[model samples]
Target chain A: MSTWSPSASRDALMARQQMYRSIREFFYTRSVLEVETPLLSQAPVADPNITPMQAGQRWLHTSPEYAMKRLLCAGYGDIYQICKVFREGEAGKRHNPEFSMLEWYRVGWTHQQLMEEVAQLLQMLLAERFSTLPTLHLSYAQALQSYAQLDVHHCGDQVIARHGQALANADLDLDRDGWLDVIMSHQVEPALPHNTLIFIDQFPASQAALAKLANNEQGVLIAQRFEVFFNGMELANGYQELTDAQQQLQRFKHELQGTQRSHDALLIAALEHGLPDCAGVALGLDRVLLHLLDAQSIAQVLSFEWQRA
Target chain B: MANYSSNEFKPGLRVMVDNEPCIMIDIEFVKPGKGQAFSRVKLRSIRTQRVWERTFKSGESLESADIVERDMEYLYSDAEFWYFMATDGSFEQLGASSEAVGETIKWLKEQVVYEVTLYNDAVVSVTPPNFVELEVVETDPGLKGDTAQGGSKPATLSTGAVVRVPLFIVEGEKLKIDTRSGEYVSRA
Candidate 1:
């Protein structure tokens, strides 16, 4: 194909447009107000795993999470935004350096409540290709135990490393959270049930990015976060917002350690100004469209993939 | 030696793993939305030719293997080592250890070009041509008009590699042999 040509077919692009319209309609009927935020920000997210693309003096926002949360703090209720997010060094069959993300927040909602809403939207959007199926809910610990034979809450670092190395078939030098991430993405995600929406929630506390910490039924501390998947591919990640400003600042500092970057002080300031309790989720729109169109690769649904762009 | 981070990993890149030179066969970028990133790679060991998978944390660096492949003409083996001369007009001769020569020694033909893989100036492996033309050194005499039976018999090539050829094939005739499977193709 010529370099000027787009990666997706004309038909695929049209389908994507239709999906965008359907998403807007879905939100419109529910009275969820749509909003926009700047793509570039003075400060990027503090999560070291997600690298933000730099543009001149500013960095392209990895997500509109901070800005959207600031809006929620400013008294915007039940808001949604569909925008392009940039993450450096992430490109593959299912990922691009720049991709579309649909993020939203609901006041006084928990991650569990947000998960049900996500299921409703997905069922409505994918009605043409699939019949509505029951959503499956599994805790992060349950997934690790069932798929990788890992007990994340109770296992030592060596045990997690052993399972990860065995699954990868080679040695892996990783920390506890690193090994857990490896097993989760490589083994557990692929082993989840297909043809239905699946929610894996209550992650280990160390991995809780912007989520509140809560005690589970067994009195073990867990992150109030959840991820949705279909056909073993992760589509969305949701979190019950951490309303404590001091705690949020500490978490950001912990993540930004060993890096030269600083946290988003504006977001922390907004958190301190009496923000209401909320839950938010960010969904990868390209992946959702890929699944809706039954496409094998994300590029097949993108007008111009990173290579062509 | 130069180093490569996980972000630079791709198929066909050779890197040192566990003190051995291994070539990457496949690579996949794996990361959770809010967790650590990893690069999962499938690699084949240069010495053992065994394939396995390994995952590396993002930003982790690996030393690049100083490996090179050269076109060389097979000379002869001296019990302990096989020798070859570079075909690049340099006429540089190099001796390969018995382990490096491995099973490809059975397909070695004098003056025939083959690929010699070297790591850090040491011969690590050799690859023979996919198809080689060799004269049959030993076989039963062909029976006239025996082609109709469609029977096959074992014929020893000049390189001492035995292959099954049609019953009509006669000794001293040059035949095309597939080096990979050690099977006869047809008369050269």
Candidate 2:
């Protein structure tokens, strides 16, 4: 059923172009360099859920994370890229297999600092269409305790199933991590203020993908990471850089390979070459546009969705 | 009897949960960028009429509900059982105390057909047609020269339904009532 017409309307397509211009203008004023890297590379994502598409013997770059980190090691300082990213088995109202990503890194900044900058960018974008949203800086531990009434470090599966309406009648056989994910995704995220920008920081260490571990004010270990949610959609995730090569390798093995080392030697080597202390983030550009345009689905804003493409 | 994966979940799907039949009322797909995807659903219990949310991990399978719906003609109810006949002339029976027929028992009329939902070969629930014509069993005498918009008064129908009809509508006059809303539609 291939058609000649574009999925989006003339006005929406025009709005998309205008939005891109605003994003570039936002970064340009800050002197953050715009850069581009190869979309196809041999390095694959350690996150198993993001299966990269194969092109000959190479793999499609999942997020341009590794290559961007390499540039940081070469003393490129702060840089940003807006490009298409690929993932597999993810298709729905909020997700598409291929979508645009707004990824950037700031040299000499902590995850907390980057989170403040992210808030400024989103507030700037939302101000153009909707009124400016006040940022709600909420710790992940506090959100669960307030909304779900469970201890983050010590909560069990039974408590989560009985906690909120999201998993109110969930199976008692679910694991601890499984229950946490369900509660956070459905219960906590939705209950956050819709007209406000939400920043949830300090996640469980088990979910720390590439982030460095840090001690919270309570002397408990937490990942130096943060996620942003707006209008009931997860818009971005950021992490404090993990600079030690040995520890980076260990984390990749634990997170991706199930206790086995991966074939990705390039990222570790780049870390060994001394990546400057920095924080980086990746945001879903399509989802952001959906909220800005008051559209229900990502397909409405995009020129063509996966099925149409 | 059948199986469905979380990816197959949608509204109006019936699935068995914890040994009781339930129907899915709503479903929303929630997935993380690098973690398990879950189908967040709202399910209404067929027996209790209670609705609650459930989250199923992607690729997880659920047993399809052993529920069936058919066109059944209403038959007389003995003290203990409400009987109905299928179009093929087969009789089906449900206990009067069964959850399916709890509220429907009040609006039932003799010899009227209904869309009956059955679970495990027993009647679970019945839905009457959207519009049913029933004679007004009780009403005040009509005033002279009353038209459709003059006024409306409460009239009791043969199926134990109470509706507000125009002032010209009197006892024994057939009136069309919207079964879903129990409102007067027009003269039959």
Candidate 3:
């Protein structure tokens, strides 16, 4: 039989309790409503990029984003949920087939406002537990320029090609976003603050999947999107909601035609049900715990992984 | 002349890349948020000990290598080569310097059969069995109160290979060792 120490088990239980308490208290203070949604749905998310695990001829809900948005249209206003999400073929040090996700939505809030609130909540939560906070902010264009020396918004495909050539030692086969992500993860992300949270905002319009677009102070068109990264690990992705049903349909179709290329009848039906104007974010809870506990792999925090399961 | 697709690829499955025998090492599915999907694979050249990477568009097909395996008996080792006798009563030999054989030579016994990998009629590699039982030849005596966790001691095997064993394990005991990771499993 394997040996287990009482002290280690107690510490783990304490951490889990604190995490739940912190989340509930944060939402309660903000006056955001907590709600539960169905784990299984007749219709799956239509975006081809995400594959839903099948359960007895039905699809597992990839995320609670769709149903939560329907509630917003029904006038539920600000809401958040801590729930389980499933995605196939996403196993790694940072990924799992099944995982815990903390998703929140804000009605009438722009993507920028949501980004600010996420940063504040993270800072407050970390401070409560660790007695210190680490956070930084950067524009997506600035991050690319600082690490890769290429301005993603203003640069052409040729510039990306040149960057790929320079990064040949990384052993990455060059494609547009592949090259960009390689540079970001390898060169730029590692150099960010380790003790502080780093926020990368103002993504290019093309990379913003479901985010709205607006002209910043420089009058350059930028997507209302932001990402939270801690110690080179991506923890959360948030966006300013796109309210135009026609534009949303076009974006979904564009994603479907691309790599994810699968049709979702449910998402289409939801569109027909009239989705409301709202902003939402999906955070990877396991990744956050990895950073908080200074663990190397998601398997460490999970009770059991795919191999063990 | 059938084409092999990415869906049919797995470890130890040989495939022809640019008419050369290359074995897949690590295979991953990578695709951008936009654009075409591709399978990224790291392959090792069988002839030369060089490693390289390649990306194939999803659903693309390639030729599979004509590879096979044979059972051979170890005969003896000379200064410049190690010789083996095939089950078909044919004697085949390969140039294996002491360094090339490395620790595996210590475990080699006469008349014992091993699986040898061949690519295009050329011997490429040898794989030892997962578990091997060997007797310990030398180690310090176990001491009382050494039962604390995370304790280990060096023990030399009869094959002249020294490995770390638990403090409680003594010399002259046969133990099962994992060949792949070189770790002690249990007393045989």
**Highest DockQ scorer:** 1
lDDT for residue B175 in candidate 2, whole number 0-100: 85
TM-score of chain A of each: 0.97, 0.93, 0.88
lDDT of 1 by residue, B85-110 (tens): 99989999999998998898778899
Index of the highest-lDDT prediction? 1
Better of 1 and 2 by TM-score: 1
iRMSD, model 2, in Å: 2.3
Native-to-model Cα distance after best TM-score fit, residue A50 in candidate 3, in Å: 1.8
Give one digit per residue, the lDDT tens place, for model 3 in A1-309.
Answer: 233422123455466568878989999999999999888887666655467788886779888877777677667789999999987656655667788888999887777678778887777656644567656789988888887777787788777866764543433455676567555654676777787778888877766767889887788898888888877777788888776667777877776664533555445556566656667888887766666676667767676665566
Q: Per-residue CA lDDT of candidate 1, range A37-90, in tens?
A: 999999977988899989999989999999999999999889999999999989
**Candidate 1 falls in which docking quality class?**
medium
- In candidate 2, stretches whose alpha carbon ends up further than 4 angstroms from where it belongs are A1-7, A48-58, A151-168, A172-174, A257-263, B32-35, B44-50, B66-68, B71-99, B106-113, B118-123, B140-154, B164-168
Error of 3 at A71 (Å): 0.9
Most TM-score-accurate candidate: 1
- DockQ, per model, reads 0.56, 0.38, 0.07
Candidate 3 residue runs with Cα over 4 Å from true position: A1-14, A124-131, A165-175, A185-187, A258-277, B1-46, B51-92, B95-118, B125-188
lDDT of 3 by residue, B39-63 (tens): 5567876656468876664566779
Root mean square deviation (Cα) for candidate 1: 3.2
Ranked by DockQ, top first = 1, 2, 3
Model 1 Cα shift for residue A95 (angstroms):
2.5
